[model samples]
Target chain A: AAGMAAPRRLKPLHHVAVSGGTHGNEMSGVYLVKHWLRDRSFAATPFLSNLRAVEKCVRYVGRDLNRTFTAEFLSSAETEDEPYEVGRAREINQTYGPKGSAQAFDFMFDLHNTTANMGTCLIMDSEESLLPMHMCHYIQTHYTQSSCPIYLYKLPGEESYSIDSVAKTGLALELGPQPQGVLKANLFAEMRALMACALDFIELFNTGTVFPAFKTEAYKITGRVDYPRYPDGEISAMVHPKLQDKDFFPLNPEDPIFQPFSGEEILYEGDSTIYPAFINEAAYYEKKVAFVKMEKRTFSIPGLHTLSLSPSP
Target chain B: MTSCFVIHEAPVRRVAIFGGTHGNELSGVFLVKHWQENGAEIQRTGLEVRPFITNPRAVKKCTRYIDCDLNRVFDTANLGRQTTEDIPYEVRRAQEINHVFGPKDSDDAYDLIFDLHNTTSNMGGTLILENSRNNFTIQMFHYIKNALAPECCPVFLIEHPNLKYATTRSIAKHPVGVEVGPQPQGVVRADILDKMRKIIKHGLDFVHIFNEGKEFPPCTIEVYKIIEKVDYPRNKNGEITAVIHPCLQDQDWQPLNNGDPIFLTMDGETITYEGDSTVYPTFVNEAAYYEKKQAFVKTVKVKLTAKCIRSLLP
Candidate 1:
């Protein structure tokens, strides 16, 4: 396994971690931190990042907080320019970061829920991150009823812009196929279990149990696909009914991807099979992404490779 | 000009046209902004038009609102509050708006209020959501219905149930909310905007004719009154386990009988509407209310005896 060159035992990573609704409308993460805030054993700092947007029941107050956590944005962000999220990112980085600084927290688990029925997923920024792979494997295998699929979403050397990117060690826990602003209790319990499992994996690593080595498969995001647009830039088609909420499902070469205003099926022209996620995401409608395409790959635990996401999704 | 039953005495009618109540819906915001800049654009013989945008900051941000929904903040208990740091953005805006156009119970309030709104639901053309059965509101509905061609601007009136004037339009003598839809928030469709502008003009003309003591021929107006809100079929944990069924999608204004498939679960299980009687559903799968878990609202058709100037005057 890659990155297995470390001594048999590494120090137990009990440094600080934080997670909750980075995007205000995602209620599962918003409430998960809320539950943690009440528990006494919780040492990690919890936050409801976009409190204003939560109250209003919208996605964000200023802009999407998830996309505003780059080092560049943290350094240059004023209380203006994507006003609410940018300022908050600066504050989060100061408290938990000066991002990628090893002197800070060991990891920050960012929780999120999607409008697409993506179910439970562990989103890793880089492919080379070994610890996350083993951890995700443990969760997926242990929880027979619920599979924890890994999705590597990093683009070729692009700096991470998500909330968890500020941490030296972390991953984004996305739970969904749920609607925005609505709290589903079952998903709530599942998210809590996943968080607990993440903590347990860290504890096992710290205490020096020789983890069983295994090759893992992950779907790496290749790029996004947008709805076809007319000359005036208005979308000319919508996601076909066949593909509405089928996140992580395969797109066969001739699969119908979109249904145009004329009601004709627009078939996918790609030659090979690919997985699509975030299908018909309500929030992405404004950003013009119909869905993100992912290519399946096999990587040994702790391997990072350069992958390019398509230009637009 | 259409002939009318003219009466002797004249009455001055003050009408308020409110837009951007939910600021992200651009059609209303744009129309009100247009009128705000060019006040002389819309005119009628005996009517006074007051055009206003309800939530300007939200409009500026191209958001639904800076704080809470302005539409839900106009309840009597929430209105007229002194501005404070703790006060929500919408509550303060609602209070400020109340001073200018409302305190619906007061004599100083506008004679009629038309609050413009948009929805992402498949409801298209002109959808009028009015709560009260006041004769004036019904007459205006009928006038607009007759004004538009059948295929062009088909008007659908939904009688919303009001709880002490919670909505911005509810705080008036004759409040009518014009909801045109299938348009996403922040999108400006020319055809939808033009339909709204035409309805605003019709509202002015209808009220003008009323103020002139002219009577429309007494008529029975059909309207749908909301009775209940139906949510998505949810699991024990409140997560919706199913989606709106294919057969029920975009079936607004059609009679839905009991046992009709309403939702289809992930497991391929179909759930049907359990109500005893057939009811009409509006706002089917409205994107905005997904957070509230309300997939649609069920309503029943009722007829109103609508008379124009005579009913209001007498």
Candidate 2:
């Protein structure tokens, strides 16, 4: 129990513990946290008074904090044997408990950024959880000016796990593909407004007020392409240009990669495209592995209404 | 008297084309006609054009189908079959239309194809098919929604992957159906008529249709099905009854817990219990009930073949 120093007098209302940036590469969520910390006025609103006044705020920088919330990781914190993010997650959990008590914090939000090309999405653990979907709808409705298609997926249902595995309720706001400079700034503001909306809902829930349910029109991507880094000359270096208006990438099967000394022919084997073929060696991870766009079905769902079926007669 | 016109334009590369299948849904028909009437100006402005009218009888009748629904007759076998009294007229019209715009054996085929229409319901605007999650269709879906119906949010782009396949009789063609809202009086019909004109003009402007020099949006072929007909319960007096209550356009239908009554008819009542199943309810008036000649559910499962898969692949 690393940060279990003392049980201070809580404001006796619900608290929201937002933690994200689990993947060091994804930067949107980090900027969102930074935005919240800088724009204190959003957090200062009456809706957030209970937890805002007493709850200890912990912000983890660098490293994936989501993977560290296990019992072994917590025990290792005492020995100082675990990585910094792991130890930090342990400390946060100790202060908040495995599941933040009902008398304390009632919600969590994990923010993240995906590859710049993948569209915007909200990732959750269950279709039954309406909170994340509601927040997704609000953000898409209020913030994005263009036709920003918002997608929602159940975490474990999709064969993936995240920090939501630890918290009873949490939302992972995935900002599709990170743009370079000023656009990035605008993306941060959009993310901040989204955080405010989530925090606002949490406060309403704690006070027994009816939180406005989020209306959602669900969609799923139609195709994806993964570009895994292969041996020295295996992965080719060629510009995969996008067809006009179409998302298809034109890649010839016979293109070759020229490394310092070796070269190999490129094999185009997928149903999608890969643009900007340059590699950033600094990021040892696969250069650019995946591209996904939905075969979208846009149908509206009632706010906070997670019911899969229509009301009976 | 009702007149039908079919127009085709190949602005630049002739990547995609437009076909108005239903004459009653005259927006697309009129739009194509307007372009053809102003052909020289449009040509001077640079748009390669191709257009055709599908069912003149239905256009004259102001109904969905003429004889048999012309759209449902798209399966290959039905191409030349005289299935009804009007079969000769429809077949002749289809042959002439097919020869003009159907896929040529040459590689230079129209990139995208749109079949425009108007719905009987007040719900107006465009509906896009998500047969292929290609960039052009996705962008067009967004562009049309943002540029046209920003207020009613009338543009609906289907995002689901279609598990079932639909065959069109007019030869092998990638088709999309656009439904403008139902217009009864000729004046209101004119409003939709003008909107369709603007959409065609804008589409021409976007693609720079005739100007062979400018780059056009790369086309992605796709296919989708619109609810051509619906079936609803009718009363003893043959009055159409509303099954589920109508709510706001954006409102979510509430979930029924345990036992909930679905509908009440003079033929007795139908209730849904814990284990019983039901379909999504559609609002229908007696007029619509009669016009809804087909059930809303998919009764047949068509086998997916290698040919169909090849056709869909880019």
Top-scoring candidate (DockQ):
1
> Per-residue error at B186 for model 1, in Å?
9.1
Could you give candidate 1's per-residue lDDT for residues B183-263 as a string of tens digits?
656555445676777888777877777676665665676677777788887767675666677778767778999899887
Query: For candidate 1 chain A, which ten residues in a row score worst on lDDT?
Result: A303-312
Q: Determine which window of 10 residues in candidate 2 chain B has minimal summed lDDT.
A: B304-313
Those runs of model 1 whose alpha carbons end farther than 4 Å from true positions after fitting are A1-9, A51-58, A77-82, A302-313, B1-62, B65-314
Give the Å shift of residue B30 in candidate 1.
16
Tens-place lDDT digits, model 1, residues A99-172: 87866666788888876778898899866776677778878877666877789888887788888777776788
DockQ, model 2, C-alpha based = 0.01
DockQ scores of all models, one per candidate: 0.05, 0.01
Q: Could you tell me the lDDT of residue A189 within candidate 2? A: 48
Report residue B307 deviation for candidate 2 (angstroms). Answer: 23
Write one digit per residue (lDDT tens) for candidate 2, span B39-85.
54234243345555567665554444545555555444555555466
RMSD of each: 10.6, 24.4
